[model samples]
Target: MESEAAIFAGAVFSLFGGGLLVWTATCVHNHRPVAHGVRPVPSATLAGVVAVLALAIGTWCFGRL
Candidate 1:
């Protein structure tokens, strides 16, 4: 039961993280500035990539359990 919950949570996180990664990439490609230049493209891209990676790891761990 706990494992199932963890898997479900992981799935949700992974889905959102993946979407964020795609959105960030699209923003960077289209040269769209964010937050009035408060958040630079490269920084946002890197953060998104990291978030996706973290979520992937979490998903894998949940699956393994």
Candidate 2:
């Protein structure tokens, strides 16, 4: 049972970390273009990516807990 818990905890941490990193990188990507005199990212793309990542992390954490 403890091992199971550890595995679950590790999975949750991985999911959360992965999601956060992806989201942060995407946000940076979306912003960087404008800073360099290019068009800003499409709002829909950013929102969708963020939403998917958040959902994935939430589901993973819930399963672990």
Candidate 3:
């Protein structure tokens, strides 16, 4: 069985990534080239990349379970 921490991390990361993805979509739909308020520097491309990485890490964690 996976530890409690792994489960927690997986859930958190997955949710965060999903949220990021949604935010990105909203920005794109609005015709904005950049997303703001998530990080120190706002960027559309970076946001998308980070979202994917986060989701990937979350999936990896879940796979461990």
Which model scores highest in TM-score? 3
Error of 1 at 28 (Å): 0.4
lDDT tens string, model 3, 1-65? 45677889999999999999898888778876553455423577788889999999999988887
In candidate 1, stretches whose alpha carbon ends up further than 4 angstroms from where it belongs are: none
| Candidate 2: C-alpha RMSD after superposition | 6.2
User: Which has the higher lDDT value, candidate number 2 or candidate number 3?
Assistant: 3
Q: Write the number of the candidate with greater TM-score, choosing between 1 and 3.
A: 3
Pairwise lDDT winner, candidates 1 and 2: 1
lDDT of each: 0.73, 0.58, 0.82
> How many clashes (backbone N, Cα, C below 3 Å) per candidate?
0, 0, 0
Q: How do these models rank on lDDT, best leading?
A: 3, 1, 2
**How does residue 11 of candidate 3 score in lDDT?**
94
Locate the minimum summed-lDDT window of 10 residues in model 2. Answer: 31-40
What TM-score against the true fold does each predicted structure earn?
Answer: 0.66, 0.48, 0.80
Q: Considering every candidate listed, which one attains the maximal lDDT?
A: 3
lDDT of 2 by residue, 40-63 (tens): 555435544665665576566556
Candidate 1 lands at a TM-score of: 0.66
Could you tell me how far off, in angstroms, the CA of residue 29 lies in candidate 3 after the best superposition? 0.9
